[model samples]
Target: MPNNKDLPVSPFSPLTIGPLTLRNRFIKSATNEGSAPGGVPSKRLVQFHESMAAGGTGMTTLAYCAVSPDGRTLPNQIVLDRDTQPHLRVLTDAVHRQGAAASAQITHGGCFTFLKPQQAPRPLSSSSGFNKVGLMSGMLRKQAMSEADIQQIADDFVRGARLAREAGFDAVELHMGHGYLLSQFVSPLYNKRRDQYGGNLENRLRFPSLVLRRVLDAVGKDLAVVCKYSITEGARGGHTAEDGAAIAQILEREGAHLLVLSAGMNVESITTMFGSSFPKENRVSSNNPIMAAAMFIQSLTAPKVDFRELYLLEHARKVRAAVKMPLAYLGGAKSLQSIEQVLGEGFDAVTMGRVLIAEPDYVNKLEAGTSRDSICTSCNRCVAMMYTPGGTSCVLGQPGDAQLNAQPAALI
Candidate 1:
């Protein structure tokens, strides 16, 4: 039998982050499952993470749990609050029963939401500007956040973290990337304010830093506080790799227990994050005629980048060199060799999204020597399918798969 005894570190090795210790170094990166319909955790969502835990992942992160109702990118997105706490507890208990830790990725959408005009009027962002992403929903403009708004949002994050702790989550990942509310404050392209919250890199990081500090103060001792941020905005005028390293350092100083290194802004350079374009035919369709037409037009102009293994390694390496905090490398990690390489290079963990979606038992298979790499094609079809009523599923999955057939609650 082949032995991993001589390997510097095995992917199955335990890893410590703050007060928590994971069974292994493989983390299921937060992927929007869309199983939470009407902002409540569904049975499908519980089964989803339960499968990952039973399959041998160290931890699985639930994606984009909005800190407040207005933070939702979509109406059906899960919100961390009292009403949902019981449901979230059930989900977390299911994960714990399988012997794996669960994490909640708390975030806010900012100007990237499709909320109806009557519901939001004007979405809040770092600076007032046209909201191209929300134009189809008649949300044409975004409002710059006031000082009170910033403080309120920070408090919301703290409340969310505390709720996650009460709900039994082992960690809370603060989403400060992907052009969301916090990323809006971090990115120069979105944060154009003349005040202390804008201008230089330090100023742009002000609000995000504030949010991080507050959340840590509230729940840092109870749950591992992981901060996921873009190492680069993946666009010409956005934050670069150097800026990402600085951001990592600042986050580390603010008491982030782990830093998840990611890249690309969902608004302008999403392909940079996924490492490929959404297949034209697989572009998410809308029920609204005007929105559907707008989506079709946008599909024609969407940027494309060829997929590659370990696509974010270069950027991650830059951040790794700058901070002493535990780092989790995200993006394009599919093979056992790739995970081993990342850990060897000093990353504390490897986070996988698409691959896990394709094969929830992938880590178990690797440990059993039944597989060397994930069977996932990284086609990103699952990205589009996330908006479907049944939520994300591998197109290659055989018929009758539970995840492929789950009926989630309807969105309001």
Candidate 2:
């Protein structure tokens, strides 16, 4: 085992992510609190990001910033069209105040969007309908994208990357992970057409790759370009690890600066987001032991499968072997041991989402060697907030559990 301390340099060694240089390898991965309202970031959002900055993450990503009105998962997601540049500036400025790179993830929800058709919400997709998880009424309204519409959306991504640069953001990430619009276009199950933009893998990847080209051309080698990819789709007949490695290679060839990998669908549905049927033993996290027992009890009904958990270091190793780009492994990545293991296995960085919601100073504690006690419980209450009614706020940080998000989980 490679000790992080024994390395010739420091674990917090300097590294670059595009035009921005991070002082450390730890990143506060994009877990949104739905802090921004109506596409504009509020004062609370600024304070929240600034807090993460002060905690010592070299870079922090603003999760799922919608690229156009039609792409919003909710009204609270940040908007980055031509009209919203000024609002983004506030977020970028706050991130820079504490010497962290502010990265905005551009996305289009398409079939997974909750926008209203009456509101002229034009959901784009290579095929139609939501994933295998059925529909959420207005949320799954399918809108097949025309060639012209595809061109416009691709242009919008290019333009969004430009606006992120103008707003003073150090890096801009393209959200291709989860079961969002972009991931839908890339999945064989979601894309079933024979058109130029559907069917086989090449056609399935056409839209995302085209958008990447335009965005790269727009960012023009100055801005740091990162892509958050979904390695496991977590849906029946969805994408697999082999499929994702191929996708990562394509993105790398298209000028992606870094690859951030994760699994699961949206947070709107528990089955999709939590990956319920993945054989309980296969999940690695707090739920694993309990799930393992359940699996043993239910072995008669469940098919035999490997016990490798979704968010642990084992999966990261699998992904590292498949892709050459520096990997920012996501999903259940909360422990320092796991972080070091990822680096030792050849992954370049580790990203934490819900962990930061629980412990803002997570990286600081790890760097100081005083952080074995991280606060994230992996109860996934933060995940609940993503689609919880009025909008996602930290219930773990409220009242009875006022300090719940700050309490450390016991290592097993």
Question: Which one is best on TM-score?
Answer: 1
Candidate 1, residues 303-346: lDDT per residue as tens digits?
66779999989988999899989999998999988988998898
Report the lDDT tens digits of candidate 2 across residue range 1-412.
Answer: 9986566434487776656678888788887654555555655566667778888888888887777777776666766865667666776787888988888888887766555643344456666655332233334446577788788889878878888889888888888867677887887667777888887777788888898878878885778788887776655787777777778878877777888877655532233333333333233321323333333443343333332224445445666776676677666666776666666667677777767777777788888888865666555555445433323344456412213222211111
C-alpha lDDT of residue 126 in model 2:
67
Residue-level lDDT for 35 in candidate 1: 82
Cα lDDT computed for each candidate against the true fold? 0.86, 0.67
Say which candidate scores most in lDDT.
Answer: 1
Predicted candidate 2, C-alpha RMSD? 7.9
